[model samples]
Target: MNRWLVPALALALIAASAASLLAGTVWLRPQDVLAAIAHPSDDLPGLIVLQIRLPRVLLAMMIGGILGLSGAVLQGLLRNPLAEPGLLGVSAGASLGAVIAIYYGFSASFSLASPLFGLAGGFVTASVAFLLARGGGTLALILAGSAVTAIAAAGTEVALNLAPNPYAAYEIMNWLMGSLADRGWDHVRLAAPFIVAGGALLLATGPALDVLALGETQAESLGVAVGRMRLIALIGTALGVGAATAVAGAIGFVGLVAPHVVRPLVHHQPGRLLLPSALTGALIVVLADTATRVMRLGGPPINLGVLISLVGAPFFLWLVLHVRTRTA
Candidate 1:
């Protein structure tokens, strides 16, 4: 692994985070941001920097870090370069839960109803997938996840189609687009614990993933508990990704892209790839969120998820072509 890779990613993430704090409707100078952080005041700049941007930046980091970490673990566990956290249906299930909350006006009654429902949905779907894939190998797990994802996606679509009012539909659509805008410390508080715990669980599996890359049979013969590792990966991914989706809505592609971007730098060692992938993911999200604030795309700014998808769609195409070329 390149010695400088992790440090480089860490430095980049720091820079992006700074940019996120600085770039907004009313841009703050470096000095202003520092002042706000050092001694928060009731002034507009202080409020903007401390209350608004700080929470958003922190949430972005947590979400991105978890997504990236989970992606690396999932890819390693499944032994598939194309694998990502969403392949297990957590994001879809979370979305369905949030949509259900919005559709039923549960969000109107309780601010956290959507996120809470989203968490429950993610856990349930992941549990179902695991149960279906029990005693089976990676292929069965993948198939089970695909099935759950389809079901959750269908539920989300049904809710959207049957929305009682256009306003509710608009709210649902907006949330699905995903954004860090208007997010306060409450969201950070809601998601922090889950993301942290989930991140720890995923990171712990790095060594096992490295061995499992050789083949499940070989890994078991080498005294690695493959089933236990799979369970850990699943639970970790579900918790982290689910909480992230619950708060931020259906942000995508970070998990899929972050691991691939850092794999070469880590010499393709799954264990070494985890931390750098997480740093890269945080950098990507911070940069993307910053871009959303500065860009003048007419009336309102671009949605965070939409902007990411725009970039990720092209990257996905390139990845497919690259994979085909290698195989060919």
Candidate 2:
């Protein structure tokens, strides 16, 4: 696959996201959107088009892009088609952190603190799982991740139950559902740097990931720094996922499914798949977010996470059965 194609696809998704932002609520024509973007004070439509929708659309691009890239990384590293950021309990851990922050009212003190804590939680979980899986390779990592996920999820539930205020549960519930509504530049600003940094790290490790495909002993024999490469990839995942989960609040399936969706486009070449997966992830999230805004359920906005899980959970179960049968 031509590398240029990935960027082109990402750009197209971004354009679509932008269009979706303006189209659904008010049905702004493309020319009017362009005009509104160009000149800020034409009318209420112009203002709403530029101010309200554009930022959200851009945020969707960033979150989706990050999830896609990280998903590709996780899949490549674990050598499992089923691997996702959530698979290793990183997303759950981040959610736990965010939940704690929200429950304790830290979010009010510092809006950015929620995500920072979430990022920290993601990193700790991924690192721990990575370490547990380190010596034994893929199987060990999967087991450790599973264990961690169970533990973290239990912890999150406990925190939710123990919340001081009853309304805290509602707030936590909303956050967990992963909406892009009411998010502003503060979120973008908080998440962008970490995502960019993490993305850079992942991109830099592409050559190493290619080597890793050859098996650990083979990779090490070929002058690949397996340990360091794993560390770098883990850090990249932490930053990328942490930032994304911080802002998006555990939007599932993008990491798990995006790589699978794009793998064929890259001919199953790990390195080639990375960018395309990223683009596909971006497309999925942006499209889902757009749908969330436009698609109403009984008069309120629907939850994006529920929508994804409804679709993904069945696929995930089928995947599990398929993997087991094949292994058997």
Candidate 3:
């Protein structure tokens, strides 16, 4: 990790956030944005900036950062460069919980209930996934995660099929597509504490991860319990990613992409890669969302989730090809 990367990432996050705040439908100057944040007023621009755009912007950044941190931790846990929370089915598990909340109408009663169920779903599935493939390597974990994701997806679809009202199902479907548009401070408040705390938990495992990189036997000899470390990583990933999916739906590939982009910059040190990956993830999402708004200027609005998938899905294939070539 270069001494300067964290500060640089911080700067980039700030720049991206600023760009997002200014890029919306209502034009607000930099000064206007500053005044809107620093001063309270009863004007439309002020209301738009403070109430509508700010929460969306913050949530995008936070969700991206959470995904990034989770990705890095999972990669470190599995000791596989290609490992990611979504690819490992953690995000899908969380989304399953959110779907259940929506189906059962728990979300109708309390705004926070959905996220809590999401957190629990992710936690349980992650634990179960690892336990199901205990003593198996990265490939086993990947296979287990694929199975978990498929089951969750099927369950969600079944619920949607059985939804009592067409309108309710339609709303749930739209929410699943993911967008920061029209989000409020309530969303930000809902996800921030869990994200920050969960990210911290993941990052805290850096030393254990570094040790485990030496191989499980070596780490165990050094008093690092491999099982415990893996559990911690899963819990951290579940908390952060579950909260994010709860609030923003499943925004894919931020995790898979962020750490890879930051690894070389950080000299491939897993411990050092955490913060930069998180910051870069924040940057990726802020910009993706900004692009979404820009494209919407001339066409039907595109969802942020769809935009990231279009871009990331290709990148994922390229990565898979590259990895295969190297391994072969």
Candidate 4:
């Protein structure tokens, strides 16, 4: 796709997001949303639209884009379309740290500390998986990822179960389910730098990813430093997925599905796919989040992660089928 198209699509998505943000639990027209943006605080609706919904939507988009790009990079590196931070235990690791911090009451002491710890946990798990897979092939990577993920997920469940405070369990449950209902600029401020930096790193690795698409020996013959590229890409994935999950919890399927949805827009060129994947991911998350806020079953809202899983599970099955056919 042309460079202009990405920006154009982003703009359109932003506009749609803005409209959806305005039409939240209480419906508001597009003109009302525009008026609110123009003169925020002039009315209750304006304030809610500009101060509350808008920020959350923007943050969701940024986080989703980061996850999408990170997924694309990981899939390219592993030569597996099913590879994602969530599958590789990166999200589980981050969730473990964040939940631990929250359960231990550290989050109450310092707001930034939760994410810092979460980042550490994410890196640790990713490192373990990488080491376990380093000398082996795709099978090793998958096995390592599954093992680490299982362990970390069990640890998270244990922590939640052992928490003294009842609220802690609920909090962990909420985080696990994922939601953008009450997020604000502070969440955005906390996550944006890491996401942007990680995104830059991912974008920088695109050329190396393109070479890796040609198979390992061919890529090495073409002068691509395979090991170095993998290291950088791993670090980038940790940064992007860690920071996003730290803020939003494990918002699943964006990374796995975004690239697949937008790959055709880029004509199946791995390098060109990144931007479109990011855009599509951003659009998906923001729209899905908006749907969560708007759609209710009598009282409580639906889980964001559940919504994504509903969509992602079938997509995953289809991907497996396609991959099997291709290999066969």
Candidate 5:
């Protein structure tokens, strides 16, 4: 890894965060932003910067960082270049949970209902996957996760189908599309602890991940508890990605794309890839959210998750072609 790579990523994240604060429906100059931040007044600029954009930026950083870190860890753990947090069904479960909250009118009466349900759904589905895959290896875990994801997705679709009104269905679909728009400090408070804890857990597995790259038998021979490590990774991913989906709807692709973007910079070392991937993920999501604010497509800004998918789907195709060419 280059000595400067981490620092460079950090600098980029800082710049992205700044851009997130400044870019919105009503753009504010740097001077205005600084003034708002420093004074914390009741003025429109202050309210916009302090109350609206700041929390959204913070949530973007946390969610993106956790997704990236977890993606790197999952890739390393499974020895699969394409592995990501959602492979474990956490995101789907969370989405299902939130959808249920909305479908049942719980979210209408309680502001925290959706997120809380999302967290529970994520945890339960992840636990089911883990248990079903126990005593089996990586392949089993992947299969179990896929099954769970399918089930949860089906449940979500059923909720939509059974919705009493078109308005309810539209609301569910819009939430599923995902966005950081209108997010506030409450969301930050809700997701921050889980993201932080999950990130720490993922980061702690770095050395083990590097060892596991040599193969599971060799990793075990080196005194790495492969099963325990797998458990930790799964739990970390569920906590972080679950909370993110809970609050932000079903944002995707950050986990899938971040690690791949940073892998080369880190010389393809799993251990070193973690932090840089996290920073890059934060930068990507923050920039994407900022773009969502600025790029009004006639009627309204694009959903954050939708924009990421639009970019990521093409990148994913390119990756497939590149990999095929290399292996051919």
Candidate 6:
């Protein structure tokens, strides 16, 4: 099954990427896409395909992969099926930073300021959550995360509340709604390095996580540094999700859904679920963003975050019901 499933997911990613390039407001042909990539120029088709949509598509894929992987890593570390970066306060922390930047008009002055500050905020919140969760069991971690999430969320609301004017307030509010509109290569360049570093750290934790699944006492018996391993995962999730949220503004649920989708395919091993979860996440965001561009027949373009929330809320409800039924 690995032979077929991995390749199939790869093909799906590739196909979805191709479809993203071809299906847009202008609807470029296959050759048009190739040409735009080869020679980006001032022409309408070249400028539209190369300058606008391509970067947005790549951004969606990258952000999706990062969020998906971060969610999988956190779930593994915490041993909680409902765990995700958002629920852990990482995404909310990042959103708070970006919102603060916008509130002060710092985002307009500096291209990289929002994301960098977002990273700082995520680390701070995750650090606090870690400190609170230390020495406690799984329940402690979740409760601590919940507490931090509420705090960070309240902070974000404060930032929004203090917006200088209604327009500024609308911008701040809309940023939380999350759109990929008009994103360029600059956003990609700014976000790519942090995601790469964070993803590397996350990828390294898989073995330790697998050991961790056996319980802390058993993990220590197997020579795993349980404390250090959790630290790495905590930091990695903060970094990756912060960077993604900095650019994408709190696109939700990709990570939570992606891991659940791939877990059964990987036979329920958390370690093996990581890479496939990333792939599934890339597929989801690309397709969702694509629909946003093409399916705006008469209405305004759909925000990517809105699309995910529309699907995710229902899916999450169903998952909760299913899990409760099984436990009952």
Better of 3 and 6 by TM-score: 6
TM per model?
Answer: 0.96, 0.87, 0.88, 0.88, 0.97, 0.92
Q: Which residue segments of model 5 deviate by more than 4 Å?
A: 320-328
Better of 2 and 5 by lDDT: 5
**Candidate 1 Cα deviation (angstroms), residue 308:** 0.3
Rank the candidate models, highest lDDT first. Answer: 5, 1, 6, 3, 4, 2
Give the total clashing residue pairs for model 6: 0
Query: For model 2, how does the per-residue alpha-carbon lDDT over 3-100 read when each residue is reduced to its tens digit?
Result: 67677886879777876856665677777887887888858778777677777787888888878888898788878776787777788889888888
- lDDT on C-alpha atoms for all candidate structures: 0.90, 0.80, 0.82, 0.81, 0.91, 0.83
Candidate 2 colliding pairs: none
lDDT of 1: 0.90
Weakest 10 consecutive residues of candidate 4 by summed lDDT: 261-270
Clashes per model (N, Cα, C within 3 A): 0, 0, 0, 0, 0, 0
| Per-residue accuracy of model 3 over 1-328 as CA lDDT, tens digit each | 4889999899989998998888866777889888988896868778978898888889999899988888988888788877877765677877788878888888889876667777777777777788876887656777888898888888878878998899669767866787777678988887888888888889898888778778878989999887777767766777788788878888888898888878878777788888899998889899999888878646668888889999988987887787578669
Summing lDDT over every window of 10 consecutive residues in candidate 1, give the lowest-scoring window.
318-327
Off by more than 4 A, model 6: 109-113, 131-141, 318-328
RMSD of each: 1.5, 3.3, 2.9, 2.9, 1.4, 2.3
Give me the candidate number with maximum TM-score.
5
lDDT of 5 by residue, 20-101 (tens): 8888779899999999988899999999999999999999999889989989999999999889889999999999999999
Which prediction has more favorable lDDT, 1 or 4?
A: 1
Model 2 stretches astray by more than 4 angstroms: 1-8, 108-110, 127-140, 313-328
Worst 10 residues of 2 by lDDT: 18-27
Cα misplacement distance, residue 315 of candidate 3 (Å): 3.2
